[model samples]
Target: MAGPTAAPTRREPTPDEFVAMQQSPEFQELRSTFRGFTFPVMIVAFIWYVVYVLLATFLPETMARPFLGLNVGLWLGLAQFLTTFLITWIYVRWANANIEPRAAHIRQEMEG
Candidate 1:
């Protein structure tokens, strides 16, 4: 009769190993890819928000203009929410497709 098997322990990487991993081409590529997507998106989103705020603050009359039974400001406010959801959806899809596989591969290499 066989007894219960103990689970395998994962060994933590040493500080040098961590540094080496960070410097590896695969890790560097991953970081670059992530930044390439994130930085531009962040900049654009920030600019979009700033534009909205500026319009609402400095041009209340323009924001107050009526359109399709609702004011422009209200529509823009709703668009902000929509943009949030859309960005989240895009990030999830992009990560799953481009990021996850490379990350998994790197993790597997580190573990083994």
Candidate 2:
């Protein structure tokens, strides 16, 4: 009778292997596209929120003034909420168009 055989071991990828994975065209495209869309939108959204806060804090009188039957503060405050939703919606559309397909291709490559 033969002795039982040992199970095969799984090797972890090395740091060089990890870097090569990121250097792959599919991964690079996905990373670049995600960064390209998110960075600008994030910067714009952050600046917009900061400006509104600064204006409300330093120039309260301007915010208190009425526009479109609502105080300027109210309009600007509501705009913050609207900006969040709009940015989320745009990112979703961008991911669907640009990110998902490349990610799927990478997934398929991994599987195959």
Candidate 3:
């Protein structure tokens, strides 16, 4: 009926619409908090990696030993995985505490 109902035309989001979606106080604070958490983590991870390289290069004697049949490098490599898991855990906690409330507020704002 109605010539196949002519699919509804979708409008592109304007800058104002984009700003309204992302510029709410709750969303702005959420973005800032996440950036704050992530930037420090990135810096720490970079420093840790640099330190690891330095140890492997200049302190091979110290890192050359085996721990539990795995070489020091292997152990240190596993530590990186552990660190990633820890970061994920921290992010989950942060999301629950800091991100979720803001998200709920945004949803209410958008819906209401």
Candidate 4:
């Protein structure tokens, strides 16, 4: 009969292990920075969109504006699209500059 293979040895973590493995301050800063930047923008955008919809639905005259032959509804929709793209761009830049590195560090700490 073949002998059983030895189990892999696992070293106990030292107190310094936690210090080495703690989340980076940059990670928290990035999180709070994004939260501060995005929360208000998201709230304002939501309010603006809701008000636009309400106005368009309740007051036709208010929404009756011409833009390159398109009416207000179409124009507002286009504006919303543009706004979405802009927000996406901002988020991507934030992620690349701050979030990605922080996330990588977190993942490394978890894995280690």
Location of the lowest summed lDDT over 10 successive residues in candidate 1? 9-18
lDDT of 4 by residue, 1-112 (tens): 9999998654565667656554557556766877987899899889878987897899888578776898888888789889888888988997788778877776665545
Q: Any idea what lDDT model 3 has?
A: 0.82
lDDT of 1 by residue, 1-112 (tens): 9999999876677788889999999999999999999899989988999999999999999999999999999999999999988998999999999999999988777776
Cα error, candidate 3, residue 62 (Å): 2.2
Worst 10 residues of 3 by lDDT: 1-10
- Please state the error at residue 2 of candidate 2 in Å: 41
Model 2 RMSD, rounded to 1 decimal:
6.7
Alpha-carbon shift of residue 12 in model 1 (angstroms): 1.4
List clashing residue pairs in candidate 1.
none
Query: Model 2, range 9-42, lDDT digits (tens) per residue?
Result: 5456667766787899869878988998899999
- Candidate 3 TM-score, true structure as reference: 0.70
lDDT of 3 by residue, 36-60 (tens): 9889998998888888889889988
Tell me each candidate's TM-score. 0.90, 0.79, 0.70, 0.67
Misplaced by over 4 Å in model 3 are 1-15
Q: In order, what is each prediction's RMSD in angstroms?
A: 2.5, 6.7, 4.8, 6.7
The candidate, 1 or 3, that scores higher on TM-score is 1
